[model samples]
Target chain A: MSDAAATLKSLPQSGGFNNSPLAQWVKANLFPNWWSTVITLVLTYFILKFLFGALSWSLFNAVWSIEGTDTEVCRELKGIGACWALIAEKHRFILFGTYPFQEHWRPALLIVVFLVLYGLSTVRALWNYWLGVVWAAGLLSIGILMWGGVFGLRFVEQERWGGLPITLMLATFGIALAFPLGILLALGRRSDMPAIKAICVAYIELIRGVPLISLLFMASVMLPLFLPEGLTIDKLLRAQIAIILFAAAYLAEVVRGGLQAIPKGQYEAADALGLSYWKKTGFIVLPQALKIVIPPLVNTFIGLFKDTSLVLIIGIYDLLNAAKTSTIEPKWQGFSIEAYVFVSIIYFVFCFAMSKYSQKIEAELSHTHKH
Target chain B: MASIPRSRPAPPSIKLSLSDPVVRAIVFQVLVVGGVALLVWYLVSNTMANMEARKIASGFGFLNREAGFAISEHSIDYSPADSYFRALVVGVLNTLIVAILGIILATILGTIIGIGRLAKNWLISQICSVYIEVMRNLPLALQLVFWYYAVILENLPSAREAHNPLPGVFVSSRGIMVPVPANDPTYGWMLIACLIGIVGTVLLSRWAKARQAATGQQFPMLRAAAGLILGLPLLAWLAGGAPTVLDWPELRGFNFQGGGTLTPEFAALLIGLVTYTAAFVAEIVRSGILAVSHGQTEASSALGLKRGLTLRLVILPQALRVIIPPMISQYLNITKNSSLAVLIGYPDLVSIANTTLNQTGQAIEGIGIIMMVYLTVSLSIAAFGNWYNKRIALTER
Candidate 1:
């Protein structure tokens, strides 16, 4: 009987996974908690129902490749599946709106170039300080390919450039130019001179307060008024400048957060070493501040990437605009869902990657700083 | 050393003139000032010349002229005959409406999603993660257009096939319709009571908080405050119940009459701004909650504080300080984004300004007012944010 008691006491608690009693209880009583179990069961039922319904509509019953009118086919498949014919016929317009049909490959190539450039930038081994070269080269190649005035390709006007390439260019060029401008503005705001600081503050505040739409409106309509006669600026250039200015304002604030976080002693130390203002800033202050702000900086970049779609408001045919224009065609009018879904997927992929990249960088930085 | 400065006084005299530090500082200040002044002067001269040659007059005088255009959404009584200045004010007010609404909705949704993201349930967190990731990455403009076209516009029944669910409510491809309040004189008093209730509740909440701090006892402040605010208004309404009447919408043929209708354009713009801003707010809230160290919560729990009470008293105050600044920027973003109303032809400030500029050939004046209005609104928001931030900021000894 003593041995039996000892054996009973020595036996391990079944299904014990966690040290905490609550965790252990949850593990042991998986579906034993009445309210939670009911909720789980209900949720599971609904989720499975939704999954099956979606599968039936989108996969099993969906028209995969029917070469006929969507109206007739979709009516037959009503309450059964998605009519995907709209996307099949109108995808070209959605991807490369109003571009010459024969020259669609140019924009297609531009997309590949952009992806490759971005892919290269993501890898730590390839992300050299001088990787600006790759971006510059990529931008040039994209511009030439899309605009096509140089090196045996037909000249395409800025007006004709549309779709994803425009969106990518706007974001890429905006960041490429705005980052340096933002750093300078941030430095100026933190400068000893009151005048420079005040000016920087005014500029940043003014640009940041207004929506990107207003700025685009101003760029498209009012920019010509501010320039000299016959020195006409391209609409694309005007939009680009506006985006750069607007992005710099927001980026400056992010960078300033980094600047504020750096210890004052570092500045004093650099000063104590008799380094000049530019020397100290270039070597000490900026590098540290930039490093500290990478996550937020990348956040801003991702934001700008998404925000580039606003140029469509000013009649610049960007990716969103292209998708919109595609949907309005008589044949594709009802296929709005397919077009939007396709574009949303593209945006999701790019955005998700960028966000993950930002997270990874943040984790690496935090880990290194801890040691 | 004894041989080297023999001419200098053993007890050195204090020299105030032209020290290296002073000289250097003076030179730097002068260079900076002079350079800025020069740049400003150049831009000014260039701008003046350009404006003069273009025959564009610059000033606030045109503001008093008749606007001659109707705005789609106006909070104030306005007409096409109203002054341009008043029209701009209408636009500004409209912008504020969108911003405020977006901020409130985003905050509630974002908080819920943020907490949901950290929930113990696997399904809840996974759903939240997908929502955040998907929404955060898509361009807000595209989303807005998609919502407008694919969801709202396409799904709605056509005008002839209108869905009238109630006597005073109508739904169709055009938009939703609901009864408007009868223009009653008692509304003025209702407005006054609302103001009083707001102020009284604020004061009472403060007093209650002070009382709680002075004593270890807790007050049911939220319930009490809610009663005071709502009950007072209800009492006022009952006392003057005979003063107002309902204005029910009536369906005339295929159209809804005698009720306010929400145009698809306005609905789309509002929806876009809210959803887009909500995504950012979700991330901000999640980060804010995560930022509060785990130890703080553990400590609160260790003291035998209830979960609700601990969240109300301890975690929230700290999280709020982190949350408000970003939330303010999101508000600004929403305000600015409402200008996208122009795309679908909602007569927002930018659209109105664009129309005015196009019509009167007063591009400079029209654009200037737009810029100034935006600048003012933006500055005010920033100022308010800074003030609120300072108020809730943690004090360190």
Candidate 2:
């Protein structure tokens, strides 16, 4: 028995090819058949080639930093390697736009405030009645910081504001203002009243049927035509209104989805309680409906955030515009790839974070609903 | 007027006051309608005042005037001397070209990626997931600019040194050029043959289904359909004398001459739109496929159907019911998002309209035309989706 035990221990483990889990996994997944093996080899070849190419171009061969818009190295690397030196040189201008280089700290600080507010909102526990107060205060600060004329801080005009802060402002204000209007529209769309429903349907469909670019074009050009003579709306403000209107229409549909998902019994229960229309919707219907739609609401916000880039077309210098112009200087002209990549990463970070958070909330919501 | 045996008037059940639901609803509707009309009236009056001040014409009469601007790419014959209406048509055609091609390509690529997301191969799945996430997260505007500036303009060689990855194809910073059939009447005949084949196939399939139900016998429908479609096209092409000559692009002076050209702007727009939309399409497809239960596969397999047959008859038909409604919306998204062609200087509807608006001071008319075209297209897509959804929806007694 002792001899047999020793022999067994000495022998190689049966059915273990090299005792490597990775090799076993590869065998099962990558090369289960001759056709699969061929695919595996081809895909591996191309993927490896691309991976190395991108890695070397972006990290290994790239010129990372240059002093004060200097030339030489970046110009030589041009196509072979990324010119990240341009990003370091023009990052401030790309982030803050033409908001007076000396007052850069103001936008920078406001960005910090925005971050803090976003962080606070991201926490699940803080999602209560106080959320409104936090947002109101946050937005008010944004306005004050942006147009500061008091407290020895210089006042920056709206036109001078651009880049990351402007993107943040548009997305934030767009969501903030649009959400209530969207709710109202959603309610109107679902109302028993025919005339009300018709008007709501027409407005929502009219806005949804066209691209946001058309509305921006309307805001930039035709909005003036709809204004009283000799009176003017600021370009940024007009764009903001367009964004709000566009977002409200889309959000209304999303909100209507939530409203539809609510059981008819809930509406009946509210009605049975002798609640007035406003009281019923406000206390009972809307709270439950809005909660069900939070994930999609976040998703809509992401779309709006990405869409803010389109403001560049109408000459509002948002982040994309700032990035585009960063490379317009003669020395930096050919280095748009770097600038775009930098801004894209910024956009990606914000959007990715929001999307991931939405996914998390969606999972939680489904889990709770299941329970 | 009190009739014989008329019951005493039912005790006034519903109060005729603001507290009553019906009364409140009517009041709300009237208030909303009045508010909307008042707003519209205010805007219209303001607009007229502003138009008078600016001396801007409001109607589409400008569409008849000479465009006085050249559209670099157009499917139909057009010139700088063409009317603005003709120019708009060119823009619309350009938009349709990109939108249709984008939809087709995005669907193909998206379906592959979507399937790959559930692949047994770990590396392939991971790669596909990464592609979807990265592409989906980035702003499409940023992607379009990246394609335009970074890929096309920055890296591509000049016209003389254009890369030719395939025979009769050339890619340069200026554009891509591919050979086209040299004025082929034979191709049109082939197209007509293909159409006939499609109709015949449909009829054959209907007869096969009826026969199968009647006699419990199966027909080789797939093989017959393929032959009728592909073989008939080939036969027509041969009968019409297959034209071998192609209008291959050639380097002459600075740019490629002859052949068909896809401008850098168009190519970039197509690439960006397709790539960006594919990510979302992939997610939709993945969800759709997942929505079909594993039990379905097992049930079909137990019934002794081959894998491919099971996929064709059982899996796809079910998955498509879930896939199609979302897919239609995505197609609509492509059409709408193609408006971004304005930025990269593609002569899409929006871009050309912007130019016309600038030249003629017809901003309102231009914007109205754009909205009307897009709204009609959007509504049509929605209607088609609704119809298709009804057709595919499961029915019961």
- iRMS values for every prediction: 5.5, 4.6
Give a tens-digit lDDT track for model 2, residues A226-315. 989889999999999999999999999999999999998998888778787789999998889988999989989999999989888899
TM-scores of chain B, in order: 0.86, 0.95
Question: Looking at candidate 1, what is the lDDT of residue A12?
Answer: 75
Model 2 CA deviation exceeding 4 Å by range: A1-27, A30-38, A66-70, B1-15
Cα lDDT tens digits, model 1, A1-371, are 85676566446766645456886555444443445567667867888999999889778888766655546676477447776666677678778877888999999999899889888888878767667787778888887898787898998777777888788889888998999999989988887666678879988877887778778887887778666566888998999999999999989999999999999999888977978778988999888999999998888998999999888888888888888887675655665666788888888788788889999999999999999
Best by DockQ: 2
Give the worst 10-residue stretch by lDDT in candidate 2 chain B: B1-10
Q: For candidate 1, what is the DockQ?
A: 0.41
In Å, residue B187's CA in model 2 sits off its true spot by 1.8
Best by TM-score: 2
Give candidate 1 misplaced runs (Cα > 4 Å): A1-32, A49-83, B1-54, B163-169, B179-187, B206-220, B242-246
